[model samples]
Target: MAQRLPSAAVLVLHGGRETGAVPPPPGPLNLPGVRMLPFVRAVRRAAGAPDGDVLVRRVRYAHRGWNGGRADPLHDAVTALDALREEAGDVPVVLLGHSMGARAALRAAGHPLVRGVVGLAPWCPPGDPVTQLAGRDVVLLHGNRDRTTSPQATQSLTARARRAGARTCMVTVRGGDHAMIRRAPAWHRLTAGLVAGLLGTRSLPGPVDEALRLPPTAEATLGTLDLDRLGARPHGGPAPAGRR
Candidate 1:
């Protein structure tokens, strides 16, 4: 069988509820999925996948929410990965998700195809399961003032994730909101830089790279990285040798 040719793949996931039913026949639209359009665009432009080597796709979910123990979104993510693996041959994949979608991505990162996961304003509640993320690159960005999702909860999870043997880093978005409306460009830029770095298309911003390199110490786990200080370049040309 002839293998498909994208060198790398990125699945941009959207956010949804903790528990909710997706209406039949789409009476209500998949607004959660719709919210990720800009992210898809930003990644496409920023990833700079050489010769279009990176195939960026948005995973569509059968259900709108996580649906409690059923973990509806997780099933959908894995299904998407299964299909991606079938179509793209043996390329490494990066999972980028927002809020509820972030939770699903984190849960699904254990898939063989996934290299890492980036969560934006994720819903990493207590005991969300860190074992699935072992040996994976986990990057989380949460707004300090987000009322909908607790930033501290994600920080706690990152701390645990670091201990669990995952290369982890969390950025505290100051003055930002849950929806990423405030400081939107910063969120998008940071996300793009992180994804590009994960995809091996560009070098990671200094602070992020340093944070990830830091040993899983108490200070590193509890500490935060500055978004601006990370030197988030809008257009990173290309990655050098031995960059992950």
Candidate 2:
């Protein structure tokens, strides 16, 4: 009999600016469905159900603003993770976060039940070095043309993670801006490939390899289009007719 595929749980946390109640733009950096629903869909497709067993369980939390107050968003995230672990019943867990949420995922890495963490466009705020990541597998994905959070920030964090003894790799998407990845098929492909690899699924080229390439100017202009106009609310709900 074939060995059963190990169950995997995935938790996604969204990032937002500290001041605003409305939340920030969703893009490659944040996977805000308004901005990157296509990429999210691609990732879901890539993390296919394992043969005779479910390979993935997904959970998402999108904070309206930065949890700079007494209630630590990180702690809340850990609590949610613990709940997910209990619900999963011994399945391996993978934590995925973008931007500020990535910071929370990094802090949650030391949890005994977690198998790995993926940080997309992670930004490390000033704090004690992330010592919890030691011995865990981590993948950091960032766009080279990202202006919101520079690649340098990710490089520095990766270096710090390495020094803390974490097994980590940083993948840079070329000619890709923070939000451009959502429009370019390559972004979906890269993300799907990464998730599939982690899930031990058969490797396949992402849709980007065959998608049309937009020039830098056009790519930048794509950001001007308000994703909120796409008819979906921030976390996958229907938008109010007049709101978008």
Best by lDDT: 1
Worst 10 residues of 2 by lDDT: 204-213
Candidate 1 regions off by >4 Å?
1-4, 23-28, 49-51, 220-223, 232-235
lDDT score, candidate 1, position 14? 86
Candidate 2: regions farther than 4 A off: 1-6, 20-31, 50-52, 55-62, 69-72, 126-128, 180-183, 202-244
What is the C-alpha lDDT profile of model 1 across 1-244, one tens digit per residue? 9654998999988888777777313423666666677788888877865457799988877876688899998998999999999888778999999998899899999999999999999999797898888888989999988999988898888888887778888988888788998998888888888898888888777667667766766564444776656653733667768765
lDDT of 2 at 130: 62
Question: Cα deviation of 158 in candidate 2 (Å)?
Answer: 1.1
Q: In candidate 2, how many Å is residue 7 off?
A: 1.2
